[model samples]
Target: MRGYKQPTVSVIGASGYSGAELTKILARHPSVKLDKLYAFSQAGKKTTDLYPWLAVDMTYEAYDGEFDSDICFLTLPHGEALKLVPDLRNAGKMVIDLSGDFRLKNAEEHLRFYGREKPDDACMTYAMPELFHEEIRNATAVSNPGCYATSIILGLAPLILKPQDSAKVNTVCCSGISGISGAGKTAKTELSFSEMNDNIRAYKVARHQHTPEILQTLGTSATEPSFGFTFTPMIAPLTRGIYTILNIALDKHLPVSEITELYRSFYISAPFVRVREMPPEILHVAHTNFCDIHVAESGKDGSVVVITAIDNLVKGAAGQAVQNMNIMLGYDEALGLT
Candidate 1:
């Protein structure tokens, strides 16, 4: 991240959903020199053998050896960061952590939800570029936001930038089909075809860990994260994407024209978020790094509803992680990520 050279990047957990996605993007980047891919569980195996689409390239080695890339993407699970970042950062490699570990600020707060172990004292900066691009621009350690939290928080983040004359949002988001793949490329009873095909049940209820993350990112403790959500998640048969719908209550009556102005003003410089009048569809952003958002309101009660859609594995995970990497390296920010 310190030099002007094309970055040498590496992906850990190379066989997982986000890991493979990161490998694909980096392998083609004109400025990113993809060094290696690592999957401890599938160590000593060819990545093409696992994710057949890769087809084994000579220019890059997949899971063949340990690496010393300029930038490292940790696509591991929550607690896994506690084990990897210290070693990588000590070796002077910039790190973009895609798990939940570094996103929360305090060690005790992090350990409370992610079990008893804590990550090393990391000076981690939030990596949702639209909100923290200034901070990410010079950070050595970055923490990407969760899928639900990214869509939910960013969908309504525009309202927070200004004094909401009285915008009170009551959000009820039904996360789309692809989140199960996010669960892991593993075998689970709930993820089985038999149980998931036509069945949908809400797991994690009121205690979903992402709940606090959404609140913390979007509102102040004094302002109150009174967002009550009916967050029902289903295992859809689709392979990728997350769509969130937030039903909001505005503090005062505001016109749609005014809302559009506010949204555009808030995200004019953000290249990935598209704020629209019509509802955002999953297909519009299925394979890209875009978060398409839409807003609607009821005049009678001053209520507004926001819809946000993103490819969970891309904008919600690897793509956004790379976006953070670009910022941290002082690159064009959108380099290699259109």
Candidate 2:
């Protein structure tokens, strides 16, 4: 690898929260060159203009029909990346989309959940690194997981991925409280300072878009999940992080230590997932790529509760995207992440 050159990378929609975070991470990456930053609205402005703390000297430009980089990170809003991904892939540039555009494999479910029609060729490898690492490594296009989906999937993966006959999961009821940052940089009356200062409310109860995403990852379609799953997503006053609590009912009772050991052994090779002895807090993983999970028995009726914490913008969005990029580029998975 002596004569190897670092790959050039570009970011589309670089003015948003997740986009800016991705830009900062790519700027510091050792194996990739940060080339272009595209933010159509903020085009012609310097990167430091929006983020005064960044030391990089680059201007945001509007994306033309051309892409000069080997890799492209599309951090556009929900329906935007659907328009750009085809062109980027046709140009032979590796694409990583941070939107929900290509996350669902079933087109019917996509339209039902996202309320948008996607093309038939919208099948991109789902990039949940802990579960789909090998698929992502060989993928030309990857769809990053959603914030709530990331926290919940990682919390439940150990239990459902490889289930014991005696301990099959019957029901999974979980609630996720996320920071306001998960709403992105869009201005909304409901998300205003006075409205959300000391208020917390649940939105998209059973109709959350990420519900299908979580179910899809656990090896079942949304309409026909192997186990019962219910998710409630709430927005809190904090600026970052997602805290998820899952109440699971199993066919047989498993000890708290047994469940804890199952999680630890499952994620043993996963560097970013930590199995904690005590429950993790939102602050513990606010800005880091790590997903801290803790499990405990709830009742004698074969029930248990699993708790997980992660930064909504990091492990849930930008940081996980970078992890996929590293695997795709054949670099160390923890290269820029650590």
Candidate 3:
């Protein structure tokens, strides 16, 4: 960041889980100054009121159609960013959106998965730093990948990006279990302690919104992948972290060592992804920006399973958004995150 001025930043929807996490990170960032925090519901309250541990002395204000910073992070719900992103970009403010609003390239797919109609020009650079680093560096607006999509896409990217002809993918079936915080700050009966404490259940089976995001990213890397893909998202009892298990059927058997080496090589330059020799647990990655991945043979011929763990609010949302901001500003990709 030599010879570069500290960029001013603002966070909209700072009361939500992801937004608070982003605020915490930006408060201590060395190269940027957090200029404002906006939360419609939490407006008029100090950040310390909600997060007593945060050292920043700033009040949450309502966004008044004015962005006075060089960059803005939108942690609003789906369809909400659609209303703000266009104007922000037109005003020359770099934007990073942590919702499903601008991730899908195809408007029909966005409508089918997110249940909202997308405008013709609503798409942004899909911000998976490891996969699309250069594109994000030049993008004025970036769409952060969903929590589930982060784990599943990073787990499957190495194989999909450089597929071996002998090991053509036949099917991809994944199941993700995330902590309660991923549900946001809203209160729900099903997400209560009594309901989720000693229980876990799948909600969106095959029609999960992240399914299309996973398929879309993988398809972009390789020839339109024709393999069958299914995703089941579940909510577990905890505060943070997302664990994904992927069972992939290939045309030929691939040794675990070979797969491990491939993943290691793929994420060789990726600062936040760790290729593990043993399976990763959710607790190990809790509260961190690292995504731990382990690949193994499933004891059946031509079958391999990849396990990935990440903090849904960190690597999946806020931390990854900061990583994109670093790249877009020509700073080190892992500048403030490490």
Candidate 4:
């Protein structure tokens, strides 16, 4: 008991959207100790100095040496993450990744989408604590789902993962705009305020990369040999949080009440998800880690619609990573996460 070392956590690429959020959250997380926070730009600077709002009563220190932590959080971009994950594992640090690097199972899939090599043999548990909780609990490395995938998957996993009737399904999702904060501290012409303010437009029609990640995770055992989808994203005039509306196509009809009952019963064990009576408002879930969901149907058509919303950066990324860590550590599954 006297020799115990606090489990240390590090944030690599801590200057970006998801990275910064994770840094702030982990800085205050109770069970885990904040070991090192790294940023290429603000490498030598202090955390409070870079993001004054962090106000955590800490100074920004340089990543002057190798970091040793029970777990390391990667907020790096997809391409960069592949390189970092393998080394981190070799160094014997368990990992929790917030990027898309390790989510896809096939290496070629990673290459096809991001033009990057798959991290070879760097096995990681897909970190969607609800469906893959067991895998995560024993896994050495963890891959967090993409932001959009988190909202969409949670909205539909109960039906798709273990389809009650094994009927086929389809899905659609929409996300709100966040401040350039979501884009990170980096500079991008497309994400500039002038272009994003007071505007709403769907960018990637069917080419959003997250589409395949979503389909891969949620559409696992469907019988259809080929699938078709319509996915579109818009830039809402907000700073953070993504409001997503997803519709799931079911081949068989289930009563709206039964559907609600099923969802309520299905997610009863999931802490961060809430099944609401009326469709949930984004604001209710906006600064929190909750995913508020509502279900509906036209009755005649064998289709069901699920509307879900969340703070894209939270439940969609950092918060989910923490949830996976809680599972992996066998701590209170909700400890320090809620």
Candidate 5:
């Protein structure tokens, strides 16, 4: 390790679940030096106060407009990250945002869904390493995909990548069952342990903020294909992970075995995506960065069902951000992730 140099990194929203997970992952990252831990409200608190399990002894600093790190991660909320990312990029800092602010390319769509004006000069690449590996590698700013979007998009990518008739493709419906952690660390009366126990409920029916994100990715991932999708996000009793069922209707039918092979081939070079024989379960991917996917053919028509499971906090947010960081820094994609 002699004569080796490492980039300095910082986490802006270090108190939140995604931020804390990013902090933990960066702490173990061999290539970067975690230099600052900033939080808006929990500024003076130690990381152990928020996450008792982490071995780090760093105290959170109040997020003043001062940061001198080589790379910065904004794990803040949707509307919050917009205000900071542009400035960070201007100041010559590589920024990876784990928010929906930069995911939507259209400013009007961002306002329509997130109920806020998009950032003035937001130019960033959407970071889904398995799909946008080249873009993320060359970009200074990266927008991490949403949890539900990550699960559903990876499940459908194989089908979308192929040539198909736009008219023949039917509706794509996805139902995602997520653990309570997807709601974030904020305390809500409905998200309480007493209320959340033994309960399954859908919150954002047809208007989840992540809906457009999935649509946008699907629209571009395929060539000359018009496929619309409906995403319903539900909350389960557990504390981590997401399970998504994607029902895709197409004009052409491929056997289940062929579909599985297609998916496996699509992710052949991806270090974190796994193709499974049986449907993926949340427990298998709980603390890891892996997204487990299963493909099956159903109905007499040309319908293929894809089931995917991933840790919402990991592959969906923090881990993917770090993976992008690795790519941007020219390190092995699975360097610290494994």
Candidate 6:
């Protein structure tokens, strides 16, 4: 740490799940100094008081104007970030937004899922580093993908034959129950220990907000011509990690061995993506940024199954945001991530 030029960084909405993860990673990041932590309501309190687990001690301030840093990570809610990101970028700050605000290419797509009018500004490049590393590297603003979107997109990327229409690809995604942390630190009766204990219930069937975000990413990718999928999200009795069971309808069947090899070959250059011989478990990637993937044959006609596991707040949100920041700043892609 002696001769390195540390970049100054800040986290807005620093009281949430993803924000806490970002704070933890940046505090120990070799080339970055977390200069500020901002929370609108918890203005004068200590970050540790809110998280009670972060080793880095910092005071949370209410956002007044711009951050005095080279980069800013916005972990605010879906509609909240659109109001602030434009100003941040205009102030010469690189922004990485962890909201669904700017993920879709068109404003109408955002409205359909989130039921809010999308910002009328220029598009922010979607920054799933494994799929769009080069674009992330050059963009001043990047929209980080959602947790479920990350799992589904990475799981199906390899088999995409050509750019298909949005209605062409037949996709079905079933995600395991997520931890209470993903719901944030707020107190809610339904998220209580007794209610969530030993229970698994599916919520947001087909109407999940992340649905369009996934479609937008897969629809725009060169290899996948189009995408159409039903996403079912369930809540499991856990504190972290997401396991997604993805079933896709294909035109023809590819051997399991060949499918596995294809996935392995496609992700060979991706450091955080591991192609596994067996299915992945959430515990293996529980607190890390890695996305473990497995491919197999399914009984459904003309369909293949892909299983992917990742820590919802890490690879899906905070960790991926930092990864994008590293790329934008010309640092080693894995510098602070590994």
Task: Judging by TM-score against the true structure, name the best candidate.
Answer: 2
lDDT of 5 by residue, 146-216 (tens): 99999988988878865545314577888999999899888899999899898999988877888878878
Off by over 4 Å in 2: 1-4
Report the lDDT tens digits of candidate 3 across residue range 1-338: 42348889999999889999999999999999999999998899999899998888899999999998988999998889999988898898889999999988778778877888988677889999999999998888899999999999999998888757657778888999999999999989988888888899999788788887888898841114478787889998879999999999887888899889989999999999999989999988887889999996654478999999999999999999999999999899888887
* Alpha-carbon RMSD, each predicted model: 2.9, 1.4, 2.0, 2.9, 2.7, 3.5
Q: Measured by TM-score, how close is model 5 to the native structure?
A: 0.94
Those runs of model 6 whose alpha carbons end farther than 4 Å from true positions after fitting are 1-4, 161-173, 220-227, 298-301
Name the top lDDT candidate. 2
Of 2 and 5, the candidate ahead on TM-score is 2
What is the model-wide C-alpha lDDT for candidate 4?
0.71
**Estimated TM-score for each candidate:** 0.90, 0.97, 0.96, 0.90, 0.94, 0.92
Per-residue C-alpha lDDT of model 6 across residues 4-43, encoded as one tens digit per residue: 3777889899988899899999998988988999998888
Write down the RMSD of candidate 3 (Cα, Å): 2.0
lDDT of 3 at 150: 96
Give candidate 1's total backbone clashes. Answer: 3
Q: Candidate 4 residues 152-217, lDDT tens each? A: 778777776664754555434344333345555677787777987777667666566676677777
Go through the candidates in order and give each one's C-alpha lDDT.
0.75, 0.91, 0.89, 0.71, 0.85, 0.81
User: Which segments of candidate 5 are over 4 A away from where they belong?
Assistant: 1-4, 119-121, 164-168, 220-225
| Best-first order by lDDT | 2, 3, 5, 6, 1, 4
Instruction: Provide the global lDDT of candidate 5 against the true structure.
Output: 0.85
RMSD of 6: 3.5
Shift of residue 338 alpha carbon in model 3, Å: 1.7
Tens digit per residue, CA lDDT, model 2, 7-47? 88999999999988898899999888899999988999998
Q: Which candidate do you rate higher for TM-score, 4 or 6? A: 6
Residue pairs in candidate 1 whose N, alpha carbon or C atoms collide under 3 angstroms: 166-251, 167-251, 177-236
Candidate 5 local Cα displacement, residue 152, angstroms: 0.5
